[model samples]
Target: MAGHSKWANIQHRKGRQDEKRQRVWTRVSREIMVAARTGGGDPGANPRLRLAIEKAKAANMPLTNVNHAIAKATGTLEGMSYEEVRYEGYGIGGAAIIVDCMTDNKVRTVAEVRHAFLKHGGNMGTEGSVAFQFKHCGQLIFAPGTSEDRVMEVALEAGAEDVITDDDGAIEVLTAFADFESVKKALEAAGLTAEVANVTMRADNSIELTGDDAERMQKLLDVLEDLDDTQDLFHNAAL
Candidate 1:
């Protein structure tokens, strides 16, 4: 598994405290809106929107809130227009980093991102500079108690690319981006629940970090993720 996926698992294991829940919901909502807008509001027809709705439900967001977001996306209500942007860079230890963002103001977002990198001992690079070091894939993380053999059987039957079992008993199923929805549905039909199901960037290689470099790198990632405009952050740092 990539470092980003491992880091996400670590965060999940910690569970959500009250303070982080609000911010997390905000980001999830944005993602839902974007998916609905791009692919239409019908979950039956829009795979991305379907996954977003599932995530919103898992987060316990109100049905009214979900409907309103869909309305905004479908133009029933006015909403701020957001553009999806990606930033590639290098963090401490020369770890390749990729940031995915949704912003109303590109200028402000880029400036803030650049500042964050500079402050954290990193620098932003051109669009393709670090993106080449990563591969886009669909990942579904199952909670503890999920059976590895069973999960693998269902996922592989659904066209998954790989299934990885971690020492902590968390199972990660990887699939082609286009096969994500089918694989997720197969798992659900087999009575397996996924803690997280989304399309994410996976690093092709990782840079090992220790001591001060590791600490500072984590701080940089925390700062980036805390930004409201930032949607997803990926890095090639090996924990």
Candidate 2:
């Protein structure tokens, strides 16, 4: 594709996780807890919780652990409370970066995030500084060789916003954040399985980095991702 589809990003990110051996379960657990606490514990009734459960399954998280996280969040068992936070910043080459976090301590999270940015040739920005460059949306990507016509038919019929076939033949389906779950279910019912599906911050444009700039920007992203409270990260850097 354009090397920027949801599928490509997932593959690249998974490759990085393989090399780093990061504890993805920790982040997934926080997501489940937050989703359950904010919406009811019932995945069938809560789109956010359903998405969290899907992510946990995709990660191969233990069923018991997932259940326990839900129980804790729903007050069936005790669990640490977390709040969602977003940090915007500028990276090397002036790339826009957005860090998503789930933390119990806002002060600690902010300091840790700020330190990572400063240490890696980046600087944190005020809230909303870089946020306007992104649009919150649900994305689904099918691999090359998928039936573009079928995807478009099903996606459009299910209330999707648009269907795009990238240069690499990957099919990308976009939908409003609110319709994500329903659209996903409809796609599955139509026997269409996406290689990657999730709600994400989509950048309107990207800043291509090369050579030393690319290296430095990657280092900054890695440092930010390694932070304990970090949940999800998005950036406008096209490596």
Pick by lDDT: which candidate is best?
A: 2
What TM-score, to 2 decimals, does candidate 2 have? 0.92
Instruction: Kindly list the per-residue Cα lDDT of model 2 for residues 113-222, writing each as its tens digit.
Output: 99999999999999999999999999998888999999999999999998888766888888999988888889999999998899999888989887999889988998
Per-residue lDDT over 1-239 for candidate 1, one digit per residue giving the tens place of the 0 to 100 score = 42233635356423742357777677778888999899999998998888888877877888888888899888999998787999989899789988899999999999989999999999999999999888899998886678888998999999999998865677889999999888988999999978777888987677878799988998888787767788888888866
Q: Residue 142's C-alpha lDDT in candidate 2? A: 88
Model 2 worst lDDT run, 10 consecutive residues: 1-10
Q: How badly does each model clash, as a count of residue pairs?
A: 0, 1
Stretches of candidate 2 off by over 4 Å are 1-8, 18-22
Least accurate 10 contiguous residues by lDDT in model 1: 1-10
TM-score of each: 0.90, 0.92
Q: What is the lDDT of residue 37 in candidate 1?
A: 93
RMSD, model 2, all Cα superposed? 2.1
